[model samples]
Target: MSGLLIGYARVSTDEQDLTAQRDALTTLGVAPERIYVDHGLTGTNRARPGLREAMAACRGGDVLVVTKLDRLARSLPDARDIVAELTAREVKLSLGGSVHDPTDPVGRLLFNVLAMVAEFESDLIKMRTREGMKVARAKGRLRGKKPKLSPRQESHLVELHHAGAHTSAELAELFSVARSTVYRAIERARPAAPSAS
Candidate 1:
């Protein structure tokens, strides 16, 4: 008797669509019902609930299918760990319709090569992102998250806080901000303490 075909898919960002991967998996013989997915989760994150569920769903002789090795793991160590787990559990891995035979030397080599490529790609992405941010910063365009409250609003909030007419909760409600925000604004308004000589 043949075992079940379990499918897994993932996307690094919420904006990225999973339709292409899902279609590919279905075309490769994975049933839609058996497909597990993780959204807005990076491959480098090993604690994905979807991946865990798919692995747990597999039994001896069951095949775990993925459209691409990168979708399964972005790092070589993670890929190796996953393969080790699968081998120990007697589960087979099918990458893009090609079943990986751990017992074969060539298959092992190919798997390692694919994992290295994935890791390289991930490293390149990180490097490019850092360089891009550096350039943006040099051009004065890489300002981080904007403050939640405007300068004028923050000043008024601080003034209201100093007035002591309202409690922190009341100030938060009045300003439509959190109590922490109120506290931060007050803290910001404080004069800097004298430095020790």
Candidate 2:
């Protein structure tokens, strides 16, 4: 064989299982020795060591296999860059069990369309993020993570602590908050008391 048929697989979180992907790639004719796998890494990241190694090992007429294009790259621009590089070296790009060789005009067109869609998806995400922030800001929200405690709630918590009427667990129950919240409230109020000195 002039080129090796290699497979690359990944899953973002530790809890996720990659058995299915491995099985699919095996059925697609890739062997364990030629497979590179990564676990608990985000799809948006390009710094995967195994991925880099596979790409570097790819020579003229080699195949770079991925279960899905998204599993290989997050956005369209990056996909295009990788695809372009592979095409320049006479490499083939295969995804989701499909053989796509850029040397052929039909495959080239498919790659181009896929790249465009990826770029468009990224732009849409950015635009939605901006609009979401705008909406939150308009409603007097800070447009980021909310504070652990509001000023009014903190004051009430402090007063209750002084009264000694409710235990931390009881306060959590009363306020419909977590036990951790009650503990945090007590800590925040405790320092201000005269006995802490």
Query: Which has the greatest TM-score?
Result: 1
The C-alpha stretches of model 1 lying farther than 4 A from their native spots are 145-197
| Candidate 1 whole-model C-alpha lDDT, 0 to 1 | 0.92
**Per-residue lDDT of model 1, residues 138-192, tens digit only:** 9988898667789999877777666667898998898888889888887777873
**Model 1 TM-score relative to the real fold:** 0.74
Runs in model 2 lying further than 4 Å from the true structure: 10-27, 31-50, 57-61, 74-77, 88-90, 143-160, 163-197
Alpha carbon RMSD to native, model 2: 5.1
All candidates: CA RMSD in angstroms?
Answer: 6.3, 5.1
Pairs clashing within candidate 2: none
Q: How many residue pairs clash in each candidate?
A: 0, 0
Q: Tell me the tens digit of each residue's lDDT in model 2 across 160-196.
A: 8778888888877777788898788778767687653
Backbone clashes (count) for model 1: 0
On lDDT, the leading prediction is: 1
List the global CA lDDT of all models: 0.92, 0.79
